[model samples]
Target chain A: MIRFDQVSKRYASGNDALSQISFELQQGEMAFLTGRSGAGKSTLLRLITRMESPSQGQVIVAGRNLNRLTRRQVAWHRRQIGVVFQDHQLLFDRDVFENVALPLKVSGYSKSHTERRVRAALDKVGLLGKEKMRPGALSGGEQQRVGIARAVVHRPAILLADEPTGNLDPLLSRDIFGLFEEFNQVGVCVLIASHDLGLVASRRRRIITLEQGRLIENREQRADVGPG
Target chain B: MSARDRKTASERSRTLPQHSGGGLLSAHLEVLGDSLRRFAAAPLSSAMTIFVIAIALLLPALLGLVADNLAGLGGNFQDSARITLFLTGQTDDGEAVALSEDLRSAADVASVSYTSRSQALAEFQAGSGLGGIVTELGDNPLPASLSVTPSNREPDAVQALVTRLQALPQVESVLVDLLWIQRLDAMQAVVNQLGRILALVLGLAVLFIVGNSIRTGIEQRQREIEVVRLVGGTAGYIARPFLYSGLLLGLFGATLACLLLMALQLAVSGPIDNLLSLYGAEFRIRFFTAVDALSLLAIGSLLGWSGAAISSLTRIYASPP
Candidate 1:
């Protein structure tokens, strides 16, 4: 579970990136974070990870206050949360298997254990056969799928994705969200931040909209019309 | 959540980075290992860089060894260290001989020889190259001297004995010819000071050498680092490879330096030993022992760790959300 209570984040430049944003994400709940660019969606996710401290309030994830955890503890806490990026941030130098296994390796799993887990995660993303391939060897959709597999590979209680489908085609994007939904069905809390309104509206899930560092809307689950 | 209980091993492993030091450690060795591996992978470039570091480090190490050799030589000189105890003109030869016997038992005195006035004059005439002139004068100006030798040739020791000798009623003013030794000690002191300064400058040079190499590696793997971070890898996780790079640089450099130092010893050993034989000494350069090698390895590893710390900070911090 993740909760933000009156959390405000102000940059050193005196710009408030998020203004008193209060929200709670229940375990196994999937929600879409809809916002314009720089509207505090990414800031919210960053606060959850304790990458940046809230200026005035508490941001709790994994039952620990973001401000209270030491820098080291925060890093450890992050190991349990999977993050998928818009850029499909995969290491080109590392083969697909190693990149996905990276998280497990850092967690001190043995080589045999890492291989088993990496393969299973890749299998979930339909990348089971591409384990030996490099990120450069994959297509954009496949790359994003790799990122998704990597994210869910750890089976983190919480998953935060920032425009994971931004670089994919509609067909691939649909499939990506379908993958997210499949993972969600298995009780993984998924929080996706995106500018794609049609995509979020079509999801028929809870939508928390942000405007100018403020949460402007928290709508009930309702599938929009005129969407695929 | 209870969901974690059902999660497969692969599912649980997706978020880890390769640089897991431990629950308590920040993965310093992981970073160091990666840095070393990266450096090792590029044998030629790594070799050249390490050679450069070796040359820089070897200077101080070599200088230290040379200074040690000099100290060894000085100790030998001290083994032959001696003092002269002169008798007054009116002192009797029997008194001089008796004084020598008594002084021989002193704590500081290693040996003493009684030189009577006739013996002093005779030896003086034979070796002064002024023997004809001395005979024509019909009188020996040279006073009876007790040639005194001590166990050591320290400045203070010689001065202390001189003071004791001067206090004798039957003795003339005590003279010490340790000015040359004083000059040598002063020279060694200067060498020590210069060696310290040289080590410091070369240490910084080692840092830059590894740092620049890490920087280049960072640039090469900029994308990969960003990827590592996005997958929930910590700054330490992202920094491991760079740390390894710095370590490898230092280790190889140290190895190269050891080789170069050995070569230098070989090149100079035979000739230097031959030259020392002329001075009737059997001397050889002392190579570094096992402890010294360990110390060198530790130093090289430390320099690399420092470089990785500095170079990886900015680069790791540059990763995006």
Candidate 2:
């Protein structure tokens, strides 16, 4: 579950990134956040992860107010949420297995448990066989999949992806969304931020659109439309 | 795999693994091993850092040895200093012998040997090559003298003893031949002070070298660090490997420095031996003991840890995740 009550974010450069924004998503809900380039989508996601605190109002995720969490608590709180980025953010110097196992390693999972979990996550993303290969050797779609495996390896309750398929082709984008759909079907909360309105509108899921640091639209797709 | 396996795998992955007490310890050990692997991966860079640190550490150790040898040389000069007590012209050989016995029993006097007036005249004549002239002159002109060596070579203690002996009856004069001792003591004091200053300067230099190395390491791994932070790695977890890398570099540098010092000591030992023989002195050069070497290693490790910790922790917190 995620909630933003009258939340506002202003950068030190005197630029407002978000202003009095308010929203909530129930547990296990799948949604997409759409906005223009300078809109507050990234800021909103960062607030949820406590990467950057809201300038004004409270941002709560999974029943905990992020404002009150200590530095140590922030790290622990981050463990409950999985985040994917546009750049794939994988350490190329290490192998795919190492990249995926990072979250499990940080959590102090037993070596056997880490191996099992890593294999499971990689297998879910169809990257199990490429564990020994460096991420540098992977295609763009494969790199994104590896990033997805790393995020979900620890079994986080909430998954936040920031423009995850920004660099992918239209077909690859659909495949990536399909992976998110599979995870959502298994009851993981998925929230994605993107500027691809055409693809976003075609998917027929929940959409919250932001414009100029303010929420301008909130709509859920009709069930009759189904998956496109 | 099949959906059945997927169902169970998701179920198992849903629950977070329970951590035993040993888990944290193992994680720390893993991080340490990871740092060693990193060092192995960049052998040339690691060796360069270690070499710089070794040279920085070596200067101080060599200075310490120089100070030790200088003190030893001063001790030798102090040991040879003696106070000569010349008896009055009227004192006979038997009286001079009795005075020497009394001087030997004194608390500050280490040894006392008497030279009768006739013996002193004979030694002076032989050295001056004026034996025939002295024989024509008749009666011996030199007075009986007692050579007094003090048990304590300290300047103040020797001066105190000299004053005490000069006040005695039947003594014409007390001559203390220790100007060279005074100059040597002053020189040794200066050398000791310089050694301490050099150690402090070189110690700081080592710290900076280690810190710079760690800074570069952090820069190279900046993206890795950012990824770790995003994935819920604590600051301590992120810093563990860098700290270990610093410590390892410092320790290796210390070991190399010790090796360098030993090689230098061996190379100069022969020359030192020849010089000692030329001076007819029994002084031998002493190398650092095991304790000293161990202490140097400890110091190097501590310096490395401090530099790494300062750089790593500050940079980790200063930058945004």
Candidate 3:
């Protein structure tokens, strides 16, 4: 579960990134945050991850207020959420398996458990066979899939993605969106920030749109339409 | 999700395998292996750093060994201190022997030997290359004397014994032959103090060297560190490998220093023994005992660990997560 109450983020350069935003997503819910570039979608996701503090407001995830977490507690808090970045953020020196195993390793999972979880996640992303290959050797779509696998490898309760399909083709983007849907089906709360309006409209999921640092629309999922 | 589902998720997280004591040990061993791999990855630079550390440690160890040998030489010289009490002209050979026998019973005196006037003159004539001149003289001028070897060699105690002997009725003069030995002991003390100071200064140098080395390592792995931190890795987890790196550097450097010291000792020991033989002194060069070697290793690793801990912990905490 994630909640934001009157959240506003202002940059040091005299620019407002988010202004007076309020939203509440129930457990087991998945939503798309759609807006143009620099519409504070990344900022909102960062607030949830405790990567950046809200200038004014309370951002709550899993019933814990982000503003009150200490440095050490922030790390433990981040462990409950899986975040996928647009750039994949994979360590190029290691293979795909090692990149995906990062979350499990950080959690101190046993070697066998880590291996099993990493393989399962990689298998889910269709990257099970490429485990031995370096990220540098993978295609753009493959690297993004590795990132998705890494985000889910620890089975975090909440998953957040920022422009995860930004560099993918239409086909690859659809595949990536499908992976988030699959995770959400398993009771993981998922929030994806993307600008792919056509793809997002076709999914029939809840959509929250922003414009110029203000929430212009909060659209609920239409039950009349099934998965496209 | 329902309340039951939330409870199950929390329970599942709680059930995730926790690190047991064996797991913790394995984690450390894994980090240590990682550190060793890092060294192998950049062998030349690592070897150079270790060599620098070894040379730094070697300077102090060598100085300490020199001081130890000097102390040994001083001990030998201190044992040669002997007090001579010359008899008055009125004392006969029988009176001199009787006085030496009586002095032998004193607790402070280890041994006492009496020389008659004729024997003193003969010994002086034989030793001083003045036999012909002494024979040309009308009478033998040397006086009978008692040589007293004291059990206590401390300067103050020896001086007290000298004063006690000076009060004897038949003793014309009391001579304590210990000035050169005392000077040697003082010089040995100075050398020992200097060695300690040098060891401290060089120890600090070792600490800084390892610190700088670990700093460079952290800088090179900055991206890896960021990724680890972003994925919920603790500061200690990120620092484990670097700490091990410092430990390996110190341990290997100390081992090299020990080897260098042994080589140095072997190279010079033969010539030193020859020199000592020429002076009629039997002394052998001493190398580090097992305890000394263990201490060197312990100190080396401790310095290395501390340097790494300071450098990595500060940098890890200072940087934003």
Candidate 4:
């Protein structure tokens, strides 16, 4: 579960990234955060991951206040929430398997357990066969899949993505969305930040919109669009 | 939510277990292996750094060895100090022999040898290269002397013994041959002091070398470190490989330095022994012992670990996570 109560973040450069933001997502729920560029969507996701503390009010994840966590506790907190970046952030020097196994390795899993989990996660993203190939040798969509596999490899309670499909084709973007839906159906809370209004609207799920650091809209559609 | 769904959700909330004791050991081994691979990846630079460390360590080790050998030579000089007493001209050979016998029983005197006037004259004639002039003289001018070796060779102690000998009625004068021994001891002290200063300076040099080397390594792996931190890696985990790198560098450097010292000792031992033989001194050069080698290794590794720790703590861990 993730909750934000009257959260406002002001940068050191005197710019308001988010102001008076209040929202809550229950357990096993999925939502899309849609906004134009510089609309504080990325900042909101960072707050959830404890990468940046809110300037005012509270941002809570898994019943723990982000502001109260110490420096050492921050790492443990981040481990419970999976994060995917638009750039994939995979190490180019290592193969696909190593990139996907990074989270599991950080969690101190045994070698055999890590191998099994990495393979299973890679299988879900359709990257199981490319385990030995380096990220530099992969296509844009495949690399994004590797990043997705790495994020969910540890089976985190919550998943956050910031423009994960920004560089992908429409078909590949749908495939990435489908992977998030699959994780969400299995009791995993997922919140995605994206600007593609058309793709986001087609999902028939709850949508939260941000404009100039203010929440302008929170809407839900009831019609089931089924798996895409 | 259904009970099965709630069970799965609770399970997902629980993260993997922390590393066990065996797991921690394996993790260290993994880091060590990673460090070794890194060295293998950049052999030239690693070898160069190690060579610099070796040369730095070798200087202090060699200086210590020299000081030890000089101290040994000084001990020999102290042991050879003796006092010679000249008897009055009226004292005959029998009186001189009797005086030598009496002095031999003294506690301070280790041994005493009597040289009659004729024996002293013969020795002077043979050593001074004035045989023909000495033979033409009808009467010998050399005085009978008693050479007394003292058990205690301290300057003050030798001086006291000389004073006691000069008080004898038949003794005209007393000569203490300990000034050269005292001068040798003073030179040994100076050499030992120099060695200590050099060791301090060079030890600091080694620390700086290892620190700078590890700093460069951190810079080259900056991106890797950033990614590790982003993925919930602890500070200790991120710094482990670098520490191992510093440790290996220092350990290998010390090993090389030890080898260099042994080679130096072997190369010079032959010539040094021959030179000592020419001086009629039975002294052989001794190389570093096992204890010395072990100490060098320990110092090298300790310096390396400290250098890496300081570099990583100040550079990477100083910033917020």
> B21-102 in candidate 2: lDDT tens per residue?
6776777788888888988998999889899899988988888888888888887767778889999988888888888888
Report the Cα interface RMSD of each model, rounded to 1 decimal.
6.3, 5.8, 2.9, 3.2
Residue-by-residue lDDT tens digits, candidate 4, A1-228: 788999999998999999999999888889999999999999999888876888999997777788998777878777777889899889997899988888777777777778899999999999889999999999999999999999998888889999999999999999999999999998788999999988998898899999999999988867676544
- In model 1, which runs have C-alpha deviations exceeding 4 angstroms? A8-17, A36-38, A222-227, B1-33, B40-49, B85-93, B114-145, B166-176, B208-226, B234-236, B282-291, B310-321
Model 2 achieves a DockQ score of: 0.37
- Pairwise lDDT winner, candidates 2 and 4: 4
lDDT of 1 by residue, B1-321 (tens): 556334423443544444333522434554555555666688788778888888888888877777776777666666666777778888998888889999999988889988888888899888888888988998888899988887556888887887888898988867666776777677777777778888899989999888888888888886776555545566776777677677767877887777777788889878887888887875455666667667777888788779768878866665433
Can you tell me which runs of candidate 4 are displaced by over 4 Å?
A223-228, B1-13, B84-177
Worst lDDT 10-window in candidate 1 chain A:
A219-228
Collision pairs in model 3: A27-B1
**Global lDDT of each model?**
0.78, 0.86, 0.87, 0.87
Q: Which stretches of candidate 2 lie above 4 Å from their native place?
A: A198-204, B1-47, B77-81, B93-143
TM-score of 3: 0.90
Note the residue pairs that clash in candidate 2: none
Per-residue lDDT of A99-199 in model 3, one digit per residue for the tens?
A: 99887777677777778989999999988899999999999999999999999888888899999999999998998999999999988889999999888
Candidate with the greatest TM-score versus the true structure: 3
Here the TM-score of candidate 3's chain B is: 0.86
Top-scoring candidate (DockQ): 3
Residue A133 of model 3: what lDDT?
Answer: 97
The segments of candidate 3 whose C-alpha lies over 4 angstroms from its true place after superposition are A10-16, A225-228, B1-17, B92-142, B163-170, B173-177
**TM-scores of the candidates in the order shown:** 0.82, 0.87, 0.90, 0.86
* Ordering by TM-score: 3, 2, 4, 1
